[model samples]
Target: MYLLMMLSAAVVSYTATWGARYVGNRMELFSPIRSRDMHSTPVSRLGGLGIFAGFAVALLIASQSFFVKDIFRNNDAPWGILAGAAVIVAVGVADDLLDLRWWIKLIGQSAAALVVAVWGVRMTIIPFIPEPYVIDSDAVSIALTAGLIVTTMNAFNFIDGLDGLAAGVAIIGGTAFFLTAYWVHRTAILLDRSDLATLLTAVLVGACIGFLPHNWFPAKIFMGDSGAMLIGLIMASAGIVSTGQITSGLYDRANGIPTIIPILLPFAVLFLPLLDLGLAVVRRTALGRSPWSADRGHLHHKLLDIGYSHRSAVILMYLWTCVLAFGGLALAVFQWQVVMAVNLAAMTVMAGVTAWPYLRHKAPGLGPRSSAEEE
Candidate 1:
């Protein structure tokens, strides 16, 4: 059933992207090439609209399915998610077209987060404490949820520099999330628990997969801020809705995984972008610049500088995201010691590849220097 829905969303999104590209070109809505831009040719930045269409339509179809009838009949959270997605996409489209100021974009993100919070998708539990505690203050819950949503949106936007980077990461991260949520739903004893989170993640992954062809390196159209933030918002909301609603006792601990897996998993899936976002802010602020200031100092830029091709850099990042995200998921279903061993091995390989340029440079007569090395 889930597979069918995912495929449907994928097909719709793939078709919609063609239409979006055509409209964007006809209307002269190409993304402006900047000094830091990876692409030289003008490309439409309207791919987000295609993604939104796919996601929204998928949910509407799911709403009518008997299999997930309870999810729709009982929970308002899905509607909130849809509404929030629309809000962010609108903000993203405006920014794509008009180049809105950072504060203005922030405001749009907050509004979208608030919409989801109001519909009961806000964070309710504080994880990582020895004894997980429920958040009793409504204000605090809303604030935390909004902060997470906004942070993720920006984190994803920060990493959208490379073609297919954001969407590929989204597909990988969203799949891990969906698996985690599905595992929870299957294991939980509670009959009233909703699978809304699982459904959302599946649809989100499908949309990204569908859009990837158009957004790949030497792309036809960019998802821009709209698609990137929409992906972030949906990913964050799935985590909040699934993990936040469950208590620590409900987490499956038979596999020797910590109870904090529910909360930790989301952060792990998003680790790369969030890490990138954090580093960018610190780098900019220390230089007496606005944290939102654009530069060629991003991780992808560093990869290009280090002699990685555009495709290879993006794929390497995808590998990093998978290693972290699925590695985190492994803890929930496998023994911690085993998962840790596997993760260590994976990270070692990733680090080696990432540092290959420097390693080759230090070893004379290894090979001819690449263009980046010569520069």
Candidate 2:
């Protein structure tokens, strides 16, 4: 059943990738990225629907499966997640077409988060508590859950500036969840718990892979608001479901990590996007600017400024993400200290790569700068 759903998801996603172009053509909605005003030709802005469509179809199919049964059977499982997702998709589609106010989009995102929160998924961690299981059923927990959900949703949306960047990152993050779910499923004796998270993550993976070819460098279609929001909400909620809601089913010791360490798994997988958003917010607020102010100051912008071609910059970022996701997995299996040592070495190497452009700018043999260089 899982295999069938995965296959169905891939097929549906591929068809949607092709169908998106036809839909955009029929709707006569095409425009290049805003950065590329130089190109007057209109390109499709509705490519997001392709991804959304594929994801929706795959999710619907999974809903009927035994794996998805937890979500369908649980009180907050099926309806709340689905309803929240619908809100995100609808709001994003409207924003893409009509350019909705940023606050309005936030409201939609919040609505979805609330649905997931109030119904099924919420952080039960008590403030200043040590034991993992002790929780106060109070207002603080609800507030924390809402705050976390909203922040994560926006985080995913903010780092989606590059062509294939967000799609790839989201897919990678979802793949991490799928892997964790599978890993836990194998070691633990639970069947239903793995089914829901695994199926959802697999569906997300299939959808992203199907769209990646078109969304890759020199993108044929831009995912825009609809796609970004859809991906963000799912990635965020998937984390909520997988770690906060489900990991407790596993009977493992603390294993030296924090009681809430499992929650960090998704964050590690999505370190790139979340880091980009967090840094952008800090930078903007420091300059007394709204966080939403559009600027070419993202990590991608920095990569470009330092002379990495767009494709190279993107590939390097992907490699970094792999290091974070798999490296952390290694930590979970091997030792945290060893993983840290390897991570430090890899980071040093990456830093050298990043500085190569600066080194190349240095004068050769202390001679006068070339006329072209001076110019």
Candidate 3:
């Protein structure tokens, strides 16, 4: 049933993207080429509309499914998620067309997150503490939830510079999250505890997969802020829902590693984007610029600067994301020692790949001239 729902979303999103492309062209809603932009041509940034269409339709279908109808009947999280998605998409579309100020976009993102947090998707406990620390204050819970969603939205938005980068990363992270949630459901003592998380991740992954073809290199359309933030909002919501109601007992029985894996997995899965966000903020602030200032100093841009092709740069980041995400996920189901060993090996390989350009340049008669020499 979940598979069917995912497929339905993919089909709807794929179809909707064509429509969005048509509307964008007709309306002249193309994103302007900036100094930091890779593409010289203006591309429609309305792909987010298509993603939302697919995501919304998928959830609607899930709500009707006999296998998962209980998610709607017993919980308000799904409704909150849907409402938040709608809010972000509208804000994103506006930003894509009008180039709204950063603060304005932040306000919109916060409002969207609040809708979900208030609707019962807020975090209830800190997952890594020896004993789960229950959040007793509603205000604090809502703030934390909103902050996470906003940060995630911005992180994704930060990394959306490359064609299909955001969507591909979302698919990787979402799939890992889905698997983790499903594992939690299987081992969970309580029934349906992780169902919402599982369902959300499934649909999120499907939406990205459906949108990827059009958004790939030599892109037909861009997801713009709307699609990127939408992906972040949903991914964060899934993480929150997965851990919101979970007890320490679930972790105790699930693995030999510490119970921290449940909460830590989301951070690990999104490590690359969050890392990019952190570095960008620090780099900009040190230079007396607004953290929201745009520049070509992003990780993807650095990749290109260092001689990686557009597709290669995007794929390498995807590889890095998978290594972190799945490596962290392995701790949940596999022995800590084995997971650590595998992760270390994967990271070593990735590091070599990431530094390949420099390595080849430094090697004697190995490859073409470096990007520096070419420039």
Candidate 4:
């Protein structure tokens, strides 16, 4: 069933994206190149429509499965999430077409988040407390959930500056969380508890993979704000459903990492984007500019400044995201401090290797000298 849904999603996504690309210019759905933009050419901005189409189709088919049906029957979350995703995609499409104001976009995002929060998914508990502190208050839970939705949506939006950057990271992050959700579901947790997360993550992975070929370097179709924000909301929804709402079902051993994974998994999977988001906010505010002010100071931009080509910079970020995301997964699955430490060390080594070329010039004569220098 899962396999079928995945294949269906990929095919639908590819077809939809191809169609969008075909009519993008005629429809005025091409994103204009700007000084702050990475692409030199205008490209289709409705790629999010492709992604959303794939996800929606796959989800509708998957909903026929017994487990999927059971979850939907038991709660309104499944429908609510769909509704919210639709809202986001609509907002994204509008943004692509009309270039909506930042606040207007935020309002749309807030509405969607509220839909998800009040209907089914919410961070109703904080794992850090000595005893699990359930946030039973409706207002507080909804507010917190909405904040998370906005932050996550903006995080992915901020990182979508490069071809395949956002899509690749989404694939990696979604895979990691999907694995975690699957493992817990099969081994330690109940089927219903993890089904939504696992299924949603699977859909997320398929959608990204399907769209990646078109969005790769010299991108033919940009996901634009619509696709980025939609994926962000999906990721956030999976995290909330799989972990946040299942706080009481967390592993009992407080001394180990698995016990804390319910809280850490989301952060670990999305560390890079979240970091970029944080840095952007801080840097922009410090410069006395609106936090949403556009600039070329992103981590990917820095990679370009340091001589990495667009594709290389994107692949490097993919590697970093995988390391952190899988590290979190390993911590959850094995609960071994030593294993996580080793993973962290290996990630550091990878980072060093990636940076070595940039630093090679600093060590005079250490790197191959150019012919001009030899002369």
Q: Report the Cα lDDT for residue 277, model 1.
A: 100
State the lDDT at 224 in candidate 1: 88
Single out the weakest 10-residue window by summed lDDT for candidate 1.
245-254
Model 1 scores what on Cα lDDT? 0.88
Q: TM-score each candidate.
A: 0.95, 0.87, 0.95, 0.94
By summed lDDT, the worst window of 10 consecutive residues in model 4 runs over: 250-259
Give the distance in Å from residue 46's predicted Cα in candidate 1 to where it truly belongs. 0.4
Q: CA lDDT, every prediction?
A: 0.88, 0.69, 0.89, 0.83
How many residue pairs clash in all the candidates, one count each?
0, 2, 0, 0
lDDT ranking from best to worst? 3, 1, 4, 2
lDDT of 4 by residue, 1-375 (tens): 555666788888888888888889677667567787888777888899899989998888877765556656667787788889999999998988888887898899999889888885887776665565778898998999889988999999999999999999999998898887777766655545537788888888998889999999999989988899999999998888755644555454322644467668888888888999999999999999989878999999999887888889999999988888888788765647776678879888988978876887567777877899889
Candidate 2 local distance difference test against the native: 0.69
Report the Cα lDDT for residue 84, model 2.
69
| 1-375: candidate 1 lDDT, tens digit per residue | 666678878988999998999999998887679999998889999999999989999999988876765788867889999999999999999999999998998999999989988874889887755666789999999999999999999999999999999999999999998888788677878775558888889999999889999999899999989999999999999888767754645565627645578778899999999999999999999999999888999999999997899999999999999999999888888888999999999999999989998778778877687799899
Candidate 2 local lDDT, residue 30: 62
